[model samples]
Target: MTETVAEAVARRRQYIAGGTMSINRAIGPAKLFVRAKGAYIWDAEGNAYIDYHAGFAPYLFGHGDKDIDDAVIAAIGSGASLIGAGTMPWEAEIAEMLVEAVPGLEQIQLTSTGSEAVSYALRLARAATGRDTVVVMQGGYNGWSDYVSYNLMDPGDVVADHREGDEYPLRVTTAGIPKVIDTTVRVIEYNDLAAAERVLARGDVAALILEPVLQNVGVVKPLPGYLEGLRELCDRYGTVLIFDEVKTGFRHALGGYQAIAGVRPDLCTFGKAVANGYPMGVVGGRREIMALCNDPDPGRRVIIAGTYNGHPVNVAAARASLLRLKARERDVYSELERLGARMQAGIEAIFARRNYPTTFVRQGSAFALYFMDHAPRNWRDIALHNDNERDLAYRRAMIEAGVFHFPAATKQSSISLAHTDDDIDRTLALTEDVVRTLG
Candidate 1:
């Protein structure tokens, strides 16, 4: 080991905000990673770990993918990334590919990050519908925007009652957000059709936004008829429907969960694995709504402008990655599901043997281990029922045992195409021992 982890944390704190960029802090000081490759990462101290964190689920093919890296390098060498200038030909090519892959996407607007993409989606909805209020799902993370920042998975007692008599107040997660911001956004429980109906029926909501599958706090799945109900409600109320797929976009499926659910949102935001960890985001949806941005009148149009809107290097990476996924969609997605199921069965076996009541929830490659016996429906249930202390201890044990699952409780762990049967077996063995030691 070159330096103590404490020393590394202290040094990082000197520059980085809160010693890290994400609010989901580790149980202990954050590990300083230096290098990575397929399915594994090396810490600054040169400790090798099988990486379940997987760069927050963006490394779909795993870190240091040759094709994606080569594409980025080639784009840079070709001088295509001249920054803040003419549109690259590959931009339209990538957009075309996305439209073909993702259902209900007729047009796409590019952005540098998912947060920015969601902001653009919201503004487009506001412009098209001529409404101001937004309805969001509890525990759904729509990035750090003021519009979607409220009701994020917080460390403490974060979930609050959405309705108090005649009024609903915003549950601000961060401090700097104004109290008035609450009035613009309404929070509803995911998978609760009645709550969604109650909120959307008001007809004031410009957009009803949520993750089709809640990934921010342990992949809470949408119950049957839940998403379809939202779609119907949004149509009835003249509101735009948005699916914030930053986490679930390309990781679970190239077409996303919407393709599987057979329910489409009017607008959808994509990022994370879209560029295989390259900085890129895409907001795509119906042509009727997205055309609002192209409105000729300068004052009435929705502005979808950004300096890095379609950076050639990032677009190249994304195009190559998506092409790879498209080329091997059957093999890639099937392998991920196979590996994920194997890991899920192994974890459940450990808990069953240990007599620990746990709920292991998964959809495709993303999974979570909750100490609660039942499947949690939303953030409130997760807060009241899931044992954070036990989950934190389990994650800490994984960290010490050469398995790098992220530290925060209820955060989903990912399986990548780079992860093979051998990796899952090794992780299962380590997890068994960790569960044994918890007594």
Candidate 2:
């Protein structure tokens, strides 16, 4: 007999420590997803969902994208799972494409996951600058590394003392991190140039890292001249500027958000949609800084190594994804913008008649619904004013109604290249129904 959803959930809980691989996966109602194709996912019990979550914004072209899948299948057929000894053609191909695309990426190295890429970037920065302390945004999520796992979605009270030029108390996201790690990190609110300068001016800081647009907390975009200001400050202070673009990379543009912003960082990290959901991460930037990974002097080398660092299958998928993005750049981005605009407009109209305070914030194909009157400027703004309960409740309702929005406050919902006008129409209708019953 096949196991039911309940049985599967129970069995998972019995074996898995938290019934999920990642703690973030614990959010929302559980479902046993049997299969997924294009813009839809099917549960084991025959229920289908118009998937807006898109595996945490990785599926830019949608699930089981033919171009990426075919490339992966071809790589598997080549019978070169892990040569482990020398360079692969796919690695060179993808690296060349990434360098050509991203503005700051003169050279790049791959990792199996974004978290690992971030770790390597930080290592390079520390070695290059000869400084141990690092600075990061208060609400930004830059992988699970101890150096960065701080102040992601802290409570209002924890950040109540925050001021424009002051750093927030470091609220470590996980417990197992060493107490000494906290000493090296300083957290500041997004969009505050004064705070960033104050922290970086200490002259002991190694690197200042951030998501250019602050995506981790529902798209708090940088204010005018913010990126440029940070660039100037980093140059003045001799600190390495790193853009943790894992969430904002290819999803926003082929060259990553740095290309769009036109303010290049010394180093940038990428993953997720770069491979169209394949497990691949990239760290690239100025050739001098990146070359530290294979420095001639043993003392100067910042080592970067992984068994599956440039696995052929993953490299193939990334190469295919970038080629398709480059070939159909106009059609692809325009369609994504169209679909995203339509969804945002529909949601705005739905809540216009009602007295609910809501803001539909979007950047390119990524979007979020915050139950607040105005767009949030930073995490403290969301924590102090946004209605967390209502946002989560609305998302939970949508999930039950077969429109899969991650049922958590401030988590982004994605629109894929495969999402059709009909998908948007159905999503709007479902949004209306959920909004009606939200009370």
Candidate 3:
């Protein structure tokens, strides 16, 4: 007797309930993946699905690239762990590549995850400036840490109703964060220069952290001159401008959004695509700002030290990934843009023909479907989604039709160098069919 798919799913759910760190509201019966190669993944029951999320936008070379795998194997054979050592040779190589690729990155500090990198960057900014207040953009997500989670509006709507003038200034998204942490965080609207200026003029801001391209809520592109204006404001006010390029770094272009947009930030945080699926993060910036980490007086400044700051295996993977990006930069970006445009156009046509109240937002190779009348410019606009049920229904239908994506409804589908014309065509066709069925 063979167990059904439902039974397997139920068993998985039981395992999850037994004890697992529950982050997102993952479905009880998640699809159990057995293997993945190139652009497709196979489930435990040997069903294949075309993966569109690209491992949350990190596997730009696609799943199971032989070059990266070989590099990882070589590094492992040599020795994998050197947690608190002097330096791994590959770490220097990655750092050199990063500084050379990104114009604003004069020096960098490596970390194990995007969250740690971001937290460290914020701490550096505060130490360098001697200011405690951090002004975060309305919808930008830096990490899950307390210092940066004050104002993550679903659609760019800050819950001002819950605020009183200077009375316990911090608002915690989760329970573990102390209420007093709010005093160090100030929330402002993205792309709104007037609102941002009002806050920056307060003289207490140590840094202005934002995702140049918002990837979590939706792929919201920055408005014309918005990033440039912000750069100028930060400079004028002596605030450190930190671009959270974890998602947009290697995806948009070889140098990331800063290169494409032609705006230089004081500091930038990168992860996700840097190691091509390996756990790695980097915080880099002007030499002066980064030097604070090495300040002789430990008691006078912030200290950042991570156990897995630049693991040998991860560094090797990053070096290999960066080499691939450098070698095929033009072809990779062009193909992704072309294929993404085709998919977006096809999806838009489907929505138009069926008269569905849906809009697609795209930037370069990343795209997302928002159940709204128009593309969202900020978090507030995204928060206006009317039908989460329908959104989930469409996502489930797409998955059932053999298209895999991040389970989050707000996720953006990332196009990879390995995705071909046929992959794009199939994805569009399946999406069209799914939209029709939804209608």
Candidate 4:
């Protein structure tokens, strides 16, 4: 007489396309999650799991954080949300906060989701450069808009025997995308400076956009000169460079990856942890480029409009989150670093003691476990070296042992501010169990 998690998932699958709202639910058991609170989740079957997925890397302060939720509720009760007016007053405050905190971003425009931000970034680029082709990374995901739908390496990954300068055939992630997008977008492998230069030499690229760190595939860090090289090539080709930091915007530091890499893009997009689980995104860049969004000349001004672009409640949440970051910059960042280091050390120690051929890669609060001897340089390396089956095995075992991740293996995991030392220790213990069981 009682419905199980599996049963509920099955029933929902009949109506909900793909059985889940996001593509993530299709990876693991399609269970119905009932609720979540501060680094933990409960499924329909009443199983509790320590949540590290954090709703796909948005929960910096963790789920149900009172400071953020209270602000959201207060805004709504005060009639700040769902404002279909021209613009809310608090929009400027949040925008000012972002420009002040993040370096190399002089101005910004708001969007409700990361995908929309990326789309507008491309539009700005095309309008500024008067070019059609936009360059993208082979494995990097910049939202699911038609311009970026090609070459998504999840669920439909190719064998990927791609060589430098070798044209990897484009495969659209979904149907209904115009086939002509293949001509408008050029795909290049991330971290390959030679490939980047070779592609950009054509002098027809409107933009070269990618994640500063190729995060979709297990937090792949850029090689020492890779990011700097990209910046140079973008300048050489007059291509607008846009860094999509939807995942890394607020995790490692308040300034995003550019602060760490010290190489700035022409424009950058922010989402995920910006508002700490609130639906918001931002497209920011140098003053000259970003001003194109509001250029006085009609021919130059790019159209960027959304009804909920700066919802007052979400803006309030962003303000609170950014203020917390600013006030406790040292303590919050230091603690996050400590937690990330602690988790990475524990996991590495396990692999070392167990004599398993595994590698660990981490960036501040974000981390990944690869079933390979060496860290991956890019997606091609991931395809050739990373042991996906073994990686999936460990991830499933950890989930079964009460640790929650993105479900699919390629996603990078994060440790939120809500995660205490005890939480890390328990997670490490569970991780050890999973590793040992896999053996």
Candidate 5:
């Protein structure tokens, strides 16, 4: 008996279920991804979408970049991974490139994902300083690792009527995470120097881990002198400074946030765009701090080990991607900024005309639109956002109008080197249409 095409498709979905696949939402019913190229993707039905999210801001060079593809292909032909404890040539090259691009990165360690990188960096900091406590900024996301996952949000814990000069206590995001972990971690608001100093002065804190520019909460930029002040405070307090550059790395600049901010961190974790969407992460910093990993006294050292930490194929892809980025570094950043500015300006103009309650926050080329009356300074401010319904409507309209952005209302949108002037113009036009539809 011959089966019909519709029946075959249904069988496939049943046999290999897609993630969170359901037909109830505004967008998820269409399981139609067929092909992708630079800045655009075609659905199984052959409909095209102008990709604005860039795989959650990783594909800086965009999808199907020939340079990265060729490198991966060549590496696969040679071998993907080596036998126990062997070095790959591309690993050294990638390390050197990262160190050169990032300031004061005398040593580097590779990992398979951003979470692993942050996890290892925190451990290294604790081991080096012999301190158990870590200070994390409120609303800053440093991956899904257990340590950083605390203090994200809790409706019960929020101070509804927070007042000036009042201490806001840290609240855990999830329940299963031990309350003792909360004791080991201190939470403070970003760009609040006084609050950060108070937390650091506790002396038990080993490190302060944060994204130099908060992308997860929205593209929230650090207040003037905030980063420099953090660097100074950490220095004075003998605490390790860590910059979680997972999202901003490579996208903000070739050297990552440290380069753009001109502030050196004791350690920095990078992922997302490290291999241009390939699953790779890196942690690097001053040699003295990193040397804690190689302490002669084994009992006093930290060890990071992973089977696919520096998988040859990933290293090869990273090396090639880094080289391509270096060659086109100026053009990539300039074009992204130029295009981002144009898009933001266009969106703002549309908002002004419609009198919509919306604002755009940008950091370098990465930006997010907050459908709120004022800019968000922290997660609490973000929680106050009331535009969820309207934002979802706008996102659906954009998707239906041939543009793809992050489904969430508060997440950021990335402008890639692969995006052309035409792509930007088209995106602006579609965005205007979506905003106009909101009225």
Candidate 6:
């Protein structure tokens, strides 16, 4: 007999810590999905919803994409899953593709997860600069590692004392992070050039890592000259600038957002859509920095070892995903923009007709709708103005109306390549109805 949702959730918690692998998944009502295809997922109870969450924004070409799956199948059929020895041909092929696609990346090493890649990036920066301190944006998230896991969505009170153009006190997201670790991580506000310079001026910072577009706080964009300003500051301070592009890498553009922003960092890390949801992470950037991973001087080498770093299947998937994006670069990105605009416009109209104040922000296929009237410039802007309860209510209502948006405030809604004009229309119609009831 098939287990019910409750039974399944219970079974999960019975063995897994916190009843789930990621505690964030435990938020909201218990939901157990049984299957997914292009544009949609079916819950165990057989309800279908157009998936805007896209499994946390990884399904660029869409869930179960045929070409990518075929590549994985081919790789598995070749009986070369894991050599556990010397490097293979698929590794070089994928690495070459990555180097060609990303604008600022000169050398790269693979890891099994984005968190691992981020960990390596931090290590490389510290090793290269011979400094222990790292500066991170207050609201930016760069994986779950201890080095960069502070101040993600902290409580308002925790950040209430924070002043504009200043840094927030260390608010670690989880416990078990060493207290000594707090001294090494410095927090600063996003889009604040003065505050960044103040922090970096201390002259002890090893790296300044951040997402080009702050997706962690619902797509807060960099103010004009903000990224360039940070670039200049890092150059002046001798700090290694690292852009964590795990979310905005392949989903926005093949070269990552750095390519579009025209500001290159000393290092960049990528995952998520890099393999279209396959487990792959990349840490790469300027050759001099990346060379630390295998430095001729043993003391300087930043060791990045994983038995499954470049698994053959995942490499095949990454190669296939990148090739498809490269081949249809024009068509794919244009279509994504069209769909994003359509979704944004329709939602804007629905809220406008309701006279409900809302702000819709988009960057290519990724977008967010905040209950605030104006676009937020930073996480504090969002924390002060955006309506958390209403935003969560709207997302829950939409989920019930057959549109899945991850039922969380300030989280982004993604649009996949498989999402069609009809899907957009249906979602809009559903949005109109959902908004009507929200009153």
- The digit string of per-residue lDDT tens for model 2 on 192-224 reads 899989998889999999999888787788888
Better of 1 and 5 by lDDT: 1
Q: Which lDDT value does model 2 have at 228? A: 99
User: 122 in model 5: Cα distance from truth in Å?
Assistant: 0.4
**lDDT (C-alpha) at residue 360 in model 3:** 86
Q: What overall lDDT goes with each candidate model? A: 0.86, 0.90, 0.81, 0.86, 0.80, 0.90
The list of candidate 1 runs beyond 4 A from truth reads 22-27, 154-168
lDDT of 5: 0.80
lDDT of 6 at 92: 81
How far residue 52's Cα lies from its native spot in candidate 2, in Å, is: 1.0
Clashing pairs in 6: none
lDDT of 3 by residue, 1-439 (tens): 7677677666766767733334553543466667988888888778888988776788887899899999999999987668576766677778889998888899999999999989988888988899888888766788888988775663323343322222223456677887677778887667677767778888889999999988877788888998998999898998999999999998888888999999999889999889989999999898988988778888545677888888888898999988988888888788889988988888888888766588888888888888878877766566655355677778788888899877666678887767888988988888878887778
Per-residue lDDT of model 6, residues 118-164, tens digit only: 89899999999999999988878898899988988777776677887
Candidate 5, superposed: residue stretches over 4 Å from native: 1-32, 153-168
lDDT of 5 by residue, 1-439 (tens): 6555455466767756542243211233344566888999887666799987776678888898898999999988977655646675667777889898888578999999999999999998898788998988777889877799866643423745543223357666756887778678877777778888887887878999999998976788887798999999999998999999999888888888788789989999999888988889998788988887878998878898898888877788788888877898898788888988888887788787766688888875688888898887776677666376777677777888898876766777887778888888988888888877768
Please give the distance, in angstroms, between residue 158's alpha carbon in candidate 2 and its true position after superposition.
1.2
Quote the positional error of residue 332 for candidate 2 in Å: 1.3
Give a tens-digit lDDT track for model 1, residues 276-309. Answer: 8899999989998888887897766988898778
Q: Give the TM-score comparing model 4 with the true structure, all chains together.
A: 0.96
For candidate 1, what is the lDDT? 0.86
Poorest 10 consecutive residues of model 4 by lDDT? 152-161
Per-candidate TM-scores read 0.95, 0.98, 0.92, 0.96, 0.90, 0.98
lDDT winner, 2 or 5: 2
Candidate 5 clashing pairs?
32-44
In model 1, residue pairs whose N, Cα or C atoms come closer than 3 Å (at least 3 residues apart or on different chains), thus clashing, are none
